[model samples]
Target: MIFQLGCSHGLPGIFACLEGAAAIHFQDFNAEVLQCLTIPNVNSNVPSFQRPALQVTKCDAGMEIHFFAGDWREIHKLLPYAQNIDVSTGKGLDAQYDIILMAETVYSISAVAHLYELIKMCITPSHGVVYMAAKKHYFGVSGGTRRFLSIVEKDGVLASSMVAEVGDGSSNVREDQTLSLFFLFLFFNLLPCGCGHQFGHLPLIWRIKYCNRN
Candidate 1:
């Protein structure tokens, strides 16, 4: 299970699907981008794309690949597994994502909080992790990995470790970072809150729940 936020070309998310993530959801601000670049690229790579409907062939336990377009602050409603979480406790009702991937998402300082909030809302409770790639900082925009980490540090909710750093003469993190888990599983109980914060819930524990039969 994985999510690609602010997916531009969606290579990382597509790769995750190839890497065996059963479900991969791609989100972008502009619907056109998803329709144009992202969807085409995905079709070229995976052969087909799927919505929430489950479809798997007998010979293959297929993957659920979904694409969404909208502002980060509001797209949760359209996402599955999102309406099944208890935001107060940080656990999910259905299943949260095992991993969340993002690149160049943190370039906007203003959207960082909403982005983190969305992550907390959708990610698995215990073992789920996030991998983000962005320049150390965006030149015009003051948003960067360092700036986003400050929010994580201040919250004191999730522990973080730098996975890699790219020193291309740019004072930015070239690699990615993973956010530590701090909660437990909560997929048994679900309270559907429509039009509310609907970040998908999956306490992956790194659990790989696919859409097809094994």
Candidate 2:
């Protein structure tokens, strides 16, 4: 399972599909971008075969391909199989994604909170992880991984570990540390909704905290 947030050209999401992710959801801020650039790119790139177009639906049967164009805050409701994660309680959703990938999306300080919350909503609970790549700072934007992580810290819902940093004295993009990954675990409620799903035997369960609330 994979969620490609802010999938501009949809390259990363398409790559996931080519890599045979059971399901891949591509999201961006504009629908036109998807239709003009992303979809065409996908149509051209998917492994060409004599067969017809593959059917992608909500189930895990075939390679599920979904597209969404909108702000992160409102898009999750329309996202297939999006678990209703309660950020406050650190609980919700019967299932979660195996991997979440994003690149160069942390440039907006105002949107980082919504982006991180959405990640929590879409990611699988215990073993799920997010891999992000961005510069140490986005010049003139006053936004970067450092600013975004501060939001995560204040929320006390997720954890982060630095993955890599690259810098050479002479390069114009000096100290533009490459990427980071947040491997998070939380004990939150997984409630049953009208979808005929049922909760655990207990109406509520206190999940084991994932090591940090500091």
Candidate 3:
């Protein structure tokens, strides 16, 4: 299962869908964004004939597509897999995501902690991995890759590695970093985020994973 948090246009989630992920969930802060942009973008890429009814949870391929919109603090209540987690400990009861992807989602310091907590609830406790693409710093907001990593490092459950970095003469450097596992090429192709950094197509990438998976 794959989950893309704070998905604006949901490009990464769409890529996972095209890759034949058994399930892909796209989330955003606004329902309108999902209706006007995310859904349309997905449908444009996935043929109409191939799409199962949105109400249908699963199909022959074990494929499921879901979209959600709400604040990070409370949205987990509505997420199917998140319902399986023990919220107090941020561990799973029955269901959790194998892969979680987010881009430019760490720009607000106030929201970063909530986002991290939500990740803990949704990801598989033992071996789930996360792919995060963001700038090293967000300047005025004081939220960025390093800020988010500080929280992760303090927790000591997940470990991160720099997968790819982009300079391109830009003062603010951005990186595609991960927690653990897998080799895959990410073709981002000039997607610009709110922080003013544009990610170009990247090469083979490594990710971050749980440190004490047993």
Candidate 4:
């Protein structure tokens, strides 16, 4: 089974995992967002593939996709299914997952720290993969992407080849203006690190995967 954390709008990453016939768990902090996800099943842009059965809610379930409606600290309390679990205040999600994902959630330094900690908790001795994406720039803002890169590098996580690239442009209306380009980052666990930290970066698509070592 595969799980997507902080799934918003059901992106292709989550859908692709489903295509592989993996039972999918979709989670989000907002019940309304989870409720809105059901819309795509009824009117999907991708018509060829059947949508995966998605369970959405505000609390953690013993299912593959667990959505916590509050801080990661609170969600950790209810995480189940994975072993070697440890709980800590200000810690992130606590269960090992197959294919964990996040998108457009790391725009601030605090968020980056939280994300890193969350990823650490989800990783087990078995090799796992984490995929993250963030905008290159935002409304003439810079450094967020660089900061994220630095944080990941300092933590010694290996990043795979860039996955997706977006073009740069601007909109006529201020509200619609383009601020940043999106870049994807992939991390494969080669060793175990007992510690994690956070930093700052623009929002992008992020995904994490948990698998059996054997």
Per-residue lDDT tens digits of candidate 1, residues 47-139? Answer: 445332222211144776777788877877777877666767443555477777776677789999888777777777666777665556777
Candidate 3 Cα outliers beyond 4 Å, as residue runs: 49-62, 179-187, 190-206
For model 4 the local lDDT of residue 82 reads 38
- Model 2 C-alpha lDDT per residue in residues 1-214, reported as the tens digit of each score: 8777887666656666666777777788888776766566666655541122222444333676777788987878777657566656644474467667676677888888888778777776777766665655678878777788777778777777554443444332212121222211110112112122221111111111123432
Q: Residue 6 in model 2: shift from native, Å?
A: 0.4
Give the TM-scores of the predictions, in the order they appear.
Answer: 0.73, 0.72, 0.82, 0.56
Candidate lDDT (C-alpha), each: 0.60, 0.58, 0.71, 0.42
Off by over 4 Å in 2: 48-61, 90-92, 168-214
lDDT of 4 at 197: 15
Residues 9-59, candidate 4, lDDT per residue (tens digit)?
A: 545333443344234555566766655562243234323433233333221
- lDDT value, residue 78 of candidate 2: 75
TM-score for candidate 3: 0.82
TM-score: model 4 vs. ground truth: 0.56
Candidate 4 ranges with C-alpha deviation above 4 Å: 38-68, 81-95, 139-143, 157-161, 169-214
lDDT of 3 by residue, 1-214 (tens): 9988887777777667766888888889988887767776676664331442333345455678888889998988888878776756675565579999887888899999999888887888766888888877788999988888899889886777787775667467776785232223333633322233334534323355676763
Better of 2 and 3 by lDDT: 3
Distance from true location, Cα of 170 in model 2, Å = 4.6
